[model samples]
Target: MRQSPALRILAGTALALLLGVSFTQAASSTKAAAPESSESFDYGTVDSFAGAFLAARTAEADRDYPNAIQFYKKALDFSPNELELQQRLMIALFMNGDFDEGAKLAKLLEKDPAVERVTSVALSFQAIRDGSYAKAMKSLKYEGPNDLDRLMNELLTAWTKVGEGKGKEALKQLQDLKGPSWYSIFTNYNIGAIASVVGDEDGARKAFTETVTDKNGGATAPDTYARAVMALATLEANAGNKQKALDALSAGDELITNFAPFKALRDEIEAGRKPKPVIETAAQGAAGVLFSIGGALNRDGAEDTVMLYLQFSRALDKEAADTLILLGGIAEKAGQPNKAIEFYRQVPETSPMRRISELQLGLTLAETGKVDEARAHLQKLIASDPKDVRSYLAYGSVLSDAKDYAAMAANYDKAVEVIGPAPTRNHWSVFFQRGIAYERLKKWDKAEPDFNKALELNPDQPQVLNYLGYSWVDMNRNLQQGLDMIKKAVELRPDDGYIVDSLGWAYYRMGRFDEAVTELERAIELKAGDATINDHLGDAYWRVGRKLEATFQWKRALASEPEEAQVPAIQAKIEKGLPPIEADAAKVNAEPAAEPKKDDKKT
Candidate 1:
């Protein structure tokens, strides 16, 4: 999905060709001049091509992307030597997701001596996207002096070595390129990634810290800082430095308050996934080149190193408001709820995403038992942004948790009022949450209507299916429909022990005792500690006439603290004669089949 610069060039070339064709058509018709004589296309084609190309530009300005793309392609067809058109086409291809074709064109365009350094840099990116790191490095040889490409090339080349699993080689390459440059922060981060790849935790830790500290004041200093902090956190965690890991996690959480670029990296690390290998301090470098060179490292699943790098990235820039919101998210993911709240509070009242962050942080705080504080935050966000539906939803959840049923309903109503009509998934959650509150308040009529509404908005959501089914069963009404609903729920959540148990109970209620045993056994296998499932299995065994086995299961169930009133019935069952059980001769003879895992009790 991430388009590389190469694809951009291809798209640009395609568009330029379209523009050139249009130019030639117009010129040939009006000027009435030339017939082809085996020579290369007439120089007059540039005039026509340039005219049509300009018109295409206007079309692009009007948001007519397809039209623009066509005209640009025509222009290029007339004047293949047009560097500007080629560059534009490439940009278009990347934007349009035609990376493969774009990359091919980029390689051809980069061979042109007329292309500028910036254009060549773009071509380098194309090579990276094409999964040709060696080619990207090769293209950089043509890059002009005193430009950003040299540093970028060095960083990418080193990363390529790392991806090839030659960590020592990568380190040496990186060290060779280390010096005063606009890419210092980025270069250092590459060093850290390389160190971590080679299992040099101490070196990686030091490198990451230096990069994040921003002592060099490089353009990408902030990004490097954030990346370094995050990398260090993950490294500490991986090395069992729990305390330091926690501290680094805390710092990374604080950094997102002002740096948005690093947010995704922070998230990936927090999720126990590796961040993409990035040249942490990127003032400007070829896109996709780093990805290509570090493709192997990226796929190496170095989650710990990536996490540290992400944390460092989180601290890179401190002036952007979006950055702070990113920090809030990182904090929440890293299990620092209080810090998440602190970051969320950094969003000013007028910011659109402020309400969103507030809602998320409030819910997180509430879950962490800071209920009052969470509620206050939600109320504040709602007060400032009364039209925001998410804030209302968060408020309702908080009120529901606090057992304030009336307030919960009011908040949900406010959410519905603000959101008007929307898609099913978006509309259903509020209704479902409100329905739960109504059910808790013992207002069944109100709750049923809301549940029905939720189902109408998003049909067959498993949670709704299960709740409605279980409620009907508990009420001893609509037994057949309840079974159908629970069956549907089970299909949706096949691995859920609780849902499976409900199905078993429904079969038992239908007096299909044999059928009940099958599902009950599966439920027990899924949830070995479930008391209700154990008892249900015992009862089903009894009804199936497996008297001895039934009594034994009942005794086992009783021993596991069965309900007080049920103990007497179990005692009576133990005293009564039991039906015969089939002998497991294989187990008695120490057969190999006896080695089946206990949970495999349910085929």
Candidate 2:
């Protein structure tokens, strides 16, 4: 699955919903209403109902699904006809893994015109689980309101057909799916799965081959691509083509190294054991469908919606390590690192992905402020697997975060040693990070070579170009070349304020006051709150005779909170203007005597 950029700019309404602030108004409005009673017991009053609802929303915002469910239920006991409440309750139950109760609520919600696509999907999965094939087919027929929704609906329908024992028909349905070019990889992958489950070895081989060969397969649907490769490898191993099976596993490994299923299959093949079918039963086939779609949705930032699908998938196939990893990732993204750690911990010890999960767990431990534990955990991983460069990198990153540059550099050195002298293009990050570490330690000679090597390996990488260029210009060496490099970096990352500031500061150092003023103004516009950029702009303004503007810029810089060591200097400059330069007295005195001697010779 390809991760999408974060949607940090949530609209006010969405933010309110996520934070449960929307409930506050509703709760306050209901405070004066009367109590209601049930046949068996006395339910809470409207005020109590409002209080429970508010609590539920708060709990939901915090990702405390069980408490949210409890409060939602309490609120529902007072007011059962509230459709919005019903929807919230259903989602909470599903997210809490109480799918049976969620499904029950979903049955009622299916009639709601405003019901979300995820609710419909949950109902369909419930139907499938209960062996109600007709109802499942009906649920699948409800058209989705968007492109992704429609595609998922069609895919789920086809999988439902497979569950109904019409595997050939299921394959036909997938073949007929016409959508965007992005749908091709998923379509081919599911076709391969349905074929494999239906005992059509030749058909399965053909579909899996197409899926593997699809150019967009890796970028758009990596998890599905990896699954296809594993399926193809299993087919080859079954056919007694040991080398071909290994080759298939190698292909999958290139796409996603250390995938547990792929590693397990490779191990079995190497040991002369026949690997199991990738999708053995109809239920697992349904689980695969859910996993693929859910994994994709997870990447697209529909964490809550995807969580329900993955939970259902897990219920169907508990051994799906990829599903577990995706769940953990969702938890991490939701800012529930403890929950993420729990999911990561559930990865089977026999799986190759177990190590990757451990690595993530260590990072998440750090996120929770258990820095020492995270460091120790990652250190143990490095000690156990000395050749695993990732372990070293993870440990190094932890140390880097703690501002321990020396330790970070030493860890990267260990990584370089483990990787041997012949570092591949992929090893560029190791060098880049080590360079950053050395630079932070003020070891310029060591840092410069590492940065140059990083450039050699990954030419024109924006961060490397910007850093190396800025360093050279700051040191008054390679001024023009450094300026050129910084310019190129700005072009590459036009929105990066710091790179733009470097260009401006370079001009200032070269005494191009006017040009510095223009570029520095632009940099300040780009990053108005950056103290260094503000200070640099102030210096340029002062040089250009905009003394008043320079004073204002300096005030802004002071307000922006510069580094502690630099504060006193900026304060001193604000108190008194820059010191005057000494006159070249020798040059001034020698010129007159030379002119006089020339005049005497002429006479």
Candidate 3:
């Protein structure tokens, strides 16, 4: 809230706390992991400074931090005193986890106010890592990039007090802390953690209760809120209040559906196991201070700053599983799947997050085009625990990415068997995914009932509605009901281009050419340059006699690179046009498709 892209990030820093933004939020990211173009571009061949600078910028945009760092160093070598170049290099270094180099550069730039927010943070992290708590606080001076930055500084400054063994002072600072109402969850949570670290059990419990009960702030930042619940529950468990700990976890579950860490903790407590307190030392408390604000800034376009904060957080507490996992997610978002793999590999095997990290590692491997390796990894994971729906679902996803629908369907079948036919609301996705697999294999009878079952479990799910409705319309059955379902899906996800395209395509199937054209245009607007959507628009244009524009659209579709199997048909449409609009029993060969998703989207 109160921040710029950079200013907002610097101002409002919090931790991913390993509680992570909801997995649901992570699934909704706009930037999907994409394969960065790896054409052999030799930076050494670039003779000019401008050429090197441009190369650095391009690599940075593609999230190729290693190359970006190299190119930027080359650019700075050519123009050593360029202030902006130094600033950019510092950020690139931090994002790549080159903290020593970043620290050196921070010293070089610390006197310049323009880069103060980042430089101050870098310097403070260096001091903290060196165990110079007094120096760390002294280095943490610059404050105003925005309210978020100032608030983060306030929290970090308080943690520095804890580092100096001034625990009571840190608690007092938090008690008097004030900012946006959103700050309450982080503020109170950290107060509790600090108190817990210093052996003030009653004080810790009080602050944590304040955090867990702050539903409004918790709703605003659920990941931070989740961390608060875990902290409070851990405190209770350590104090021998097992039932209280379980109750807290149950409440957290109700707030955050299917969150793995909470479940992991809840199971431990249920089995008469005690969870250690979340914050055990001054440094861990300080790391939470950074994570509390840093993690809140994990949105699109702020990866650079989030990376900086998280790296610094890790420097404070090397065993911070949440910090490491979040860094992996950021790398994935930045289109650096290999870099993500490195972070995932760094997560301690003993941490509760190790399982999730391994799953992510397998997924990231698939993103790097190691499909076979990914399959073997996830398959072994599934074999490790047949009763784990998560393992099966993850395995099925890898197969789906490979377009091995037969295997995907089989994966779900095994999941269904393990689940014992009593599909609950959480199992809706299993049924839905299975239906899609069967649909791809042209087993309509099998696919239909599964789709129906998914809807029965979670009616109003937009993806299910769009797919089933569009299929019915394409087959010329249940025409009105299909159209209504598609329309409802559109209303539910008005901004989703794929659902909109399904509605438009259904209209084309019904021979409502003009209506088809209108809906297709809207779909085109939502998802520009999509080959399938462009092709559909072209077909609608031809049906409505916009012949010239129709040819333009077909050409556009071809340029966007339709699937290789569809290339020949698209070229023929451009050259000879669509077959005369005629009634035929033979269906058009475009297999029914639900909206194709960008993998691992995070919000």
Q: Which stretches in model 3 have alpha-carbon errors above 4 Å?
A: 1-41, 46-48, 142-145, 584-590, 599-603
How many clashes does each candidate structure show, in the order listed? 58, 0, 19
The per-prediction CA RMSD against the true structure, in angstroms, equals 25.6, 11.6, 6.4
The local distance difference test score of each candidate is 0.57, 0.73, 0.78
Query: Candidate 2 at 557: error in angstroms?
Result: 6.0
Q: What is the lDDT of residue 55 in candidate 2?
A: 68
Off by over 4 Å in 2: 1-78, 96-98, 130-135, 144-147, 176-180, 249-278, 297-312, 511-603
Minimum summed lDDT over a 10-residue window in model 3 is located at 14-23
Question: lDDT by residue for model 2 over 1-603, one digit each (tens)?
Answer: 453222122211221132222344456666543223122122244246776776676677667787778778888887888767887887788787788888888788777655545456777787777777777888776553455556667777887888788888988988888876667777888888888888888898898888887745555567778788988998988999999888888877776755656665777889998877757876677788778766655544467666766887876677777788888888877778898888889988765457778888887787788999999999998888787777776777778767798998999888888888787766777888788788888787988899898888888787778788877876677989988998998899787777788888888776787999988889888878988888889888888888888888888899999867668767876988555422211122110000001111100
Candidate 3: lDDT of 60?
A: 72
TM-score of each: 0.42, 0.79, 0.90
Instruction: Evaluate residue 377 in candidate 3 and report its C-alpha lDDT on the 0 to 100 scale.
Output: 93
Best by TM-score: 3
lDDT of 3: 0.78
Please tell me which predicted candidate would have the highest lDDT against the true structure: 3
User: What order do candidates take by TM-score, descending?
Assistant: 3, 2, 1
